[model samples]
Structure formats: C-alpha cells, structure tokens
Target: MARTGFDIVRSTNNRGGVDDFIPFEATMRAARAAGLPVGDYIDEVMNGTPGATQSTIDRLRALGVFAANPNTVLEIGPGSGRYLEKTLKECDPGRYEIYETAAPWADYLVDTFKVVAQPTSECSLAPTPDGSVDLVHAHKVFNTVTFLSASRYFFEMARVTRPGGRIVFDVMTETCLDAATMHAWATKGGPGHDSYPAAMPRQACVDLFETLGCSLEAGFQAPMGFASTEVLVFGKGS
Candidate 1:
C-alpha cells in the first residue's frame, strides 16, 4: 500500500528530524493569528538580528559581508524579504535575482525588494547558461532538498557562475538533528517521505562541492539556540 502524506511525514521525522522546516504560509498565518509584528519577527529570524533590526544590521556589518561588493547575486528562497534586505545592503549587487518555489513568498519578495524573482519551476542551475551570475546565495534552502537534488542544485550553481565566482549558503548541521526531530513531529508520515528529500550530512556537502568543481573557501559552525548550523563559502572553478 502507498503511504499517505501523514505517514511519510511521520517516518521521515522518526528517521531523522530537521530544523528550518517552517513553511512560508504557516509562518504568515501564525504571525497573523498572533497579531505579532510580522516584519519584526521576519527581521529578527531572517536577518539574524539578536534583539531587533539595529542589532541585525550591526551583526552583518561585523561579519565583513558589507565590505565586499558583488556584481550580480542570486538568492534562493528569500522568505519574507528579510535576507533580501540584508543582501541588498551587504552585497550591493548591480542586478539581483531571487528564486522561490512558493508563489506567495515569491510575490512577497518582489513586493518588498522591488526586484524580479525567477520562477523556480521554470529555471534551474544546470541549464541556466554559463557565467550567468557572480554570486549565488541560499539560506535554509538546502535543508529540505534531498542529497541527489542538492547535488543537482550545486551543479546548477556551478554552471551559472563565472569561473571565479562564488556560492554562499548555510545548512543545519548534525548537531541540529534534534531540531530535525521536532520538525518530523509536524510530519505525520513515515521516514524518507517528504516534499523534498532529507538534507545531506556535512561531509556529504563538502564532497558534493568538490564533485561540482568548486573549492571550499571557508566553513564555520553557527549556533541556532537548539542546533549547530554551518555556513559554507564555495568558489567556482573552470
């Protein structure tokens, strides 16, 4: 018998939980229902602001991201435009494109950034043509993508980047596996069943980059209250 959606969710959760599982719609609804400040919450989480927007700005600046200027940048899944704002301020790219699979969030990104975002359905990394971008950035986008799909995405990133361009993204580490478990509870189905495949392990991520002809420039583990997070910098090669 085929497994129901709930069963898939449950099994996936039981096998290993995930962090960064909040669907865009669910977050919007919760914010609306709580009458909580949507923009504030978004700024806090997406921007990495500690107490508020000012702190977020300060932290980003301290990270040296603002010092470097990228010519063109692509951000995958810029939920609520929080990271959108940060990228605009820090990267200061001449042209910016955001890729979002979720329609409402895509619309929200456009409204907030006043920039066009490519429909994820129509675009991909592999067939995107060569040297299309100077930088590719993804935040929490890889956590839900399966290892095989993640491999494809990395190839796409490599295909679009100039020989010297870079790809920057973050992922939840094994240390954050507990968060994955909690996320699994929200899933009702059995293991290995999800909208996307489960995330790849850290070594797997490193290997994927090497396989795609990119070199890991830097990697660091970040603390996210509950789990360990890793931010990686990849430089594309010819």
Candidate 2:
C-alpha cells in the first residue's frame, strides 16, 4: 500500500510545533529504515532514556489512570500512537478519538490502533463534546509547543472531559528545570532541536485546572528526549 504522508516543508526559524510535518516525516523515514516502530526508534535511538514510552505507561497505570476503565478517550498529538497503543491495551476504550495534525501519523494511528482521528485545529478539542470523554490526555506535546497553545489545549481538555473524568499530560515544569537539567537542555540539544525545553509553572497548572473544575490528583516524572517532564493527572469534580 502506498502510504502518502503530508508534504514536509522546511520549518523556518527552527520553530517546532504539532502541525509541523517535518518531524513526523523524518521520524517515519528513519523508523522504516531502522526496521522499528516510531516509538522504538525514539526510545532506543533518540535519547538518554530508553524504554521511555513504557515507563510512562507504567507510571500512568500506577497513578490509576487506567483504573477507571475509561470507556471513551481522546488524545491530542498522538504522533505514531505509542501511548495510544499502550492505553488501548490497558483499558481498550470503546471510543478513542485523536487530534493530530501530522496527516500521515494520524492515518497510521487510525489504521493501526482503530482510533478515530478528529479534524484538528492544533489548539482545541472542538470535535469532542463537552463533558463527554472519560479520559483526555496528551503525551510529550506540551513540552514543545508554545505556552499559549498549551494553555488553550488545557482549557479544551477540561471542556471535553466529563465530570469525574480524567485529564493527563506532560510539560516541562519546574521539577524538570533544575540547573543541571537546564545545562543538559542547552548543550545536549535534544530531538526537539529549536523550539523546545518549554517550561510551565507547576503551581499555575494546578491552580488553573482547579478553576476549570478539575483538581490535580497526581504528578510524576516522565522522560522526554534527553531529560524529563512532569506528567500531571487531574480528576474532574461532579
């Protein structure tokens, strides 16, 4: 089968984003060349952390994100569907929707994971109805995108998740920005080459989610390219 992905245009200014297809295309090309899944290539070749994706899944499991047996789930920027595949194994959610701008990766996920790929606006979960999703999440996304974009998506996550539903995502929070980590981020120049090492205030994340009717339930460290990110889990109140 001819797998036609989106056209890859050179990203100007080293600006990295969810919609930028360059990373998606390049990762696929390398993965195919390496005889590995995108996730494996990322884990084995692209970082100081190996087995990063499964580690995140294990942590989420420990946090009870999988305990609810969520019937419906929505993920933002589920590139290559590593987390999506793991989450499906954990709970096998009946209605799994995804919003991804990399057309090829989105199509790959839809085919491989049997997930619904929603039309994406890059910063909103408009296709998902308010209070309809049992679990809404993103992985390794907030750490690369701009601050305003992550903030907008946070509001949208809260909007789509049902009362008592769960929200989970990772960001480069204060915990991830120690002096040594900052040095590594600057010098190591991880996979997110240009627009990366983005940081968000941890307190602000908890405080804003609280106002959005979700309370921070748990947070833990998850590995990104070369360093780590904080995955915050929130539970919506009834």
Candidate 3:
C-alpha cells in the first residue's frame, strides 16, 4: 500500500512511542487554541527560536564555517518548515536539502521552499558525496529517537559534512527530566507526558560528538516546562 503522511506519523510514533511523536500542524493548532504565545511555543517548545536559523548562520560566519561564498546546507527533520521559511529568505546558501519524516511536510517544503526534500527513511546523504555539505543540522531530533539511533545518524552527518563544516542539533537531557513538572508527568504517564524518550546527559552527548571528530563550539539550554532542550553547535574535523 502506498503510505500517506499520517501513516508515516503513526509508524514514527510507534517506533519512538508517545515520547517521540510530533504532529506539527496539530501542535500549532493546540497552541493557538490555548492562547499561548505561538512564537514562544514554537521556539521554546518545538525547538529553534525565532531568528535562530539566521543567528546560527551569523555565528557560523564568525567561526569561519562560511570561508567560502556558497554553502551547501542539509537539515534532518525540519518540522513545520519554520526555520526553512526564514532561512530561504535571509540566507543564500548554494544548495539546500531537507530530510523530513512527515510526508505532508516534505511535500510542503518542496512546494513552498523549492528545496530538495527527502523522506526521513532515507536518512543518509547518499547523493551528497562525503565531506561535501557545508552545514548539517537537525533541530529537536536527538531526544525523539533512541540515543543509539541518533548516534548512527550523527555518524552519517559526520561523513557528509565537510572538514571545517558545522553541525547543530538539540537534545533533551537528564537534567531536563529533573524538572519537577516533568518528573511528575513521567510518573503519571498522562497525555503529553514522556514526549521525549531518549534523554541523555549533556556531557554524554558532547562526548559522543567529540568522538565523531567534531568539536563543540557553543551550546545552551532552553527551558520548556515539561522538558528542556540543549541546543549544540559543533565544527567537524578534517
């Protein structure tokens, strides 16, 4: 049977369970219905603050990631296309590619942004030769999958990212789970609880990236009420 976008969502949630599931449009609707600050919900909750993509680009410029004029960029799981929408207008990367799990979003990204979009199942950048991409990134992806799975993806990211290229991603950590509300929710097993399964210690994630031949450049914690996230940037080694 040909799979639909909702099928993809169902399968992903099955694999990662309740914790990893993210229904982007539904989330937005819920947020709007609740009268929450949509920007804050999208940024702090969904990951990647407003202007985050551009700010990262600027930071990359400072770090020499863009020593060359044209940059090839790849991002995994660019949910809701918020970052892409802003980045396409703000920065002129030589080429842009996205790996998105939700089929509807994948089509939307291609139609809306005119960027190459691949299914999340095709996680590795096969057509993109090794060490070709200037920047490889994923936002709010690590904690959604098992750490083991995320590590595998990082290995692929390392392979495709050029020497001196940049990588950015976010992870939920044990410290995030220690938040009182989060701990209680985890215990209660209520709806919207345990929405992240693969929380790791921040140091552990940094160590993994370091072992993958990347050097941590900067990182910060964004406090979401249920689960905080650590946004990290790294520079790949030759």
In candidate 2, what are the lDDT values of residues 1-238, reduced to their tens digit?
1256544443322224433644666677888998987877877876546789898899889888899799999998887787888888899788999987777778878888889999867587887889999999999888778888889899999999999999999988999898998898778864645666578999999999999999999999987766789999999998
Score every model by TM-score. 0.67, 0.88, 0.72
The top-ranked prediction according to lDDT is: 2
Per-residue lDDT for 1-238 in model 1, tens only? 1222121111112111332334556567657765655555654554344444334344445655455577778877665665667568666677788776656667767876776777464236443458878778776567656555556677777778777777877675564567565575346433554543254577777787788777887776543333335677778786
Instruction: Evaluate model 1: give its TM-score.
Output: 0.67
Error of 1 at 22 (Å): 5.8
**Residue-pair clashes per candidate:** 18, 0, 1
Query: What lDDT does candidate 2 reach at residue 116?
Result: 93
Span of ten consecutive residues with least summed lDDT in model 1 = 7-16
Q: After superposition, how far is residue 80 of candidate 3 from its true place, in Å?
A: 0.4
RMSD of model 2, in Å?
A: 3.8
Question: For residues 1-238, could you state the per-residue lDDT of candidate 3 as single tens digits?
Answer: 2233342234342234344435645665656876754444576455544445455556545655445543788888776665566555545787899876666666767886788875455345576678888888786667677666677787888888889888877777655665685666567544654545567677876887798888899876654434456778888887
Output the worst ten-in-a-row residue range by lDDT, candidate 2.
10-19
